[model samples]
Target: MSKFDKALTAIEETVNGALLLSATLLLFINVILRYVFTSSTTWAEEAIRYAIVWVTFFGASLCARNKMHVGIDIFIQMAPPLIKKCLLAFAQLTAAFFTAFITYFGWVSTELVIETAQKSPAMLMPMWIVYISMPLGSALMTIRFVAAAVAILRDKTTGAEVKNEDAVDISRL
Candidate 1:
């Protein structure tokens, strides 16, 4: 990865972690206050909801980078090597196209939300800030898919390596 890509990934990870931590802490504190002192943070639920939305979008990009999206592997697992490569490539292409589609539509939706000037109820945050995550995450996912496709094509990687990190024993499932 280039320095820029590395930095972008680091930022994503850090932000994801921070959002999760803050949400967890806030929710915990709110719960304790409510039970112990009959007090609650009005914004806690809303903040956690927004944080979850951001986490989902950001996590989608991270999942794309790692090629961890769930996919049916039975056919590819049984196919010949060349066919497996072709199938995997086609799958990646389809994924890229879908992510690009999401990116375009997401941006359009974000623009519309911005024009409406709507805000969240509790935080009064511009709705665009939350909606913006869709396009950003979709764009990142698109880039990751395209890059994976390029690498698989240029290096002639087998699809088997795609799930190498997820070495689960099916008997347990």
Candidate 2:
């Protein structure tokens, strides 16, 4: 893999690992407290909720990286080569544009959260930290979408199938 690809993969993996560990620890603690101490900390639930939000954002980015996002590929598979190429380009462009739009609004949302000094009710943590995930994830997915689009264009122009890092069988989708 290229260095860029490798770096992106590493980042995704790190985020995934951290989020998983946080979720696991929070849940474990919650369970232990409930069963053993008969008392639960309010912060634990908020922690889990924040972890979940992070997971959702990063997981979406990971899905983009892996090309595992939901799609109606059956129709694309049946189309003629040129049509398939067009369809692929259109899809990639749409994704890129949408992500870019979301990234802009996400930044605005993050700023609003920060400026307002929003805080989680239970944990009392800055809400901007959670809101920041929106722009970050959208930006990453935007990059991934652009890469995929370039690969598609290269394939169409050179008649070479670009090997995708996350390529897999349709069954897995």
Candidate 3:
């Protein structure tokens, strides 16, 4: 990978890992406090919830970058090379469009929350900070999708087969 790609991957992986670890640790400590100490942090649950939401959104972008999202490619695999290429291109473009749509609407929602000055109940953090995840994640996914589409079309035009990262091995299964 190029330096920029490596850096982006590192950032995505680091953020996802840190958030997941923090959420798990916080939950474990909260459980211990609730049972043994008979006291718990009021903000723990809310923090965990928001952490999970961010993790999920960021994870989706990570998945898009790795092409790890679930897909049923039985038909595409069976199709002729030309048809398969067309199908793959179509799928990628469609996904790009969907993610772009989400990014646009998500930003709008985040802006509205910002204007309202909404705060999260427990942490009192600006609601826009949390709400912005949708746009940010979808924007990343949109870029990935567009890149995939370009790669697919380019490879197809050059008589190369498109390769998916998560291709299933039936014999192993």
Candidate 4:
């Protein structure tokens, strides 16, 4: 991968890993506190929930980067090489358009939340911070989709296929 792609992958992986790990640890601590001390932080659950939300969004981008999204590829698999390439490109472009739509509306929703000064009940944290994840994640996914579409088109021109090493072969299972 190029340096930019490597950097983006690193950032996404690190953020997702950290958020997941932190949420797990926080939940464990909350359980211990409630069981052993008969008490727990009121905001722990809310914090964990928000962390999970962030992780889900960031993880979606990683899924796109790795080409791990589920799809019915039987027809594409059976098609001629040129037709398959075109179909794949079309799929990527469609995903890009969908994500772009989400990003635009998400940003608008987040802005509205910010303007209303909405806050979480448990933690009193600004709701916009949580809502912002939608736009950010969708934006990142849009970038990934555009990149995938470009790579697909470029491969068609150069007679090369994009190879993703992280893809799982479920049939092997």
Tell me the TM-score of each prediction against the true structure.
0.88, 0.87, 0.89, 0.89
By lDDT, is 1 or 3 better? 3
**Candidates by TM-score, descending order:** 4, 3, 1, 2
lDDT tens readout by residue for model 4, 1-173: 48888898899899899999999999999999999999999999999999999998889999998898876665565566677788788888999899999999999999999999999999999999999999999899999999988888877353225343454544576
Give the Å error, residue 130, model 3: 0.8
Model 3 alpha-carbon drift over 4 Å, by segment: 156-160, 164-173
Cα displacement (angstroms), candidate 4, residue 29, comes to: 0.4
Question: Please, what is the whole-model Cα lDDT of each candidate in the order they appear?
Answer: 0.84, 0.81, 0.85, 0.87
Candidate No. with top lDDT: 4
> On a 0 to 100 scale, what is the lDDT of residue 17 in model 3?
96
| Of candidates 3 and 2, the better by lDDT | 3
Query: For all candidates, what are the clash counts?
Result: 0, 0, 0, 0
lDDT of 2: 0.81
lDDT of 1 by residue, 1-173 (tens): 67867887897798789999999999999999999999998888999999999899889888988888998766766676667777777888889999999999999999999999999999898999999989998888888888777777765455445443464545466
Error of 3 at 90 (Å): 1.5
Q: How close is candidate 2 to the true structure, as a TM-score?
A: 0.87
Cα RMSD for candidate 2? 3.6
Error of 4 at 79 (Å): 1.0
For candidate 2, lDDT tens digit of each residue in 1-173?
Answer: 47998898789889878988988988998999999999988898788888888888778888887788876666566566667776777788789899989999999999999999999998889999999988998988898888887778777453224332443446567
**Superposed Cα deviation of residue 118, candidate 4 (Å):** 0.4
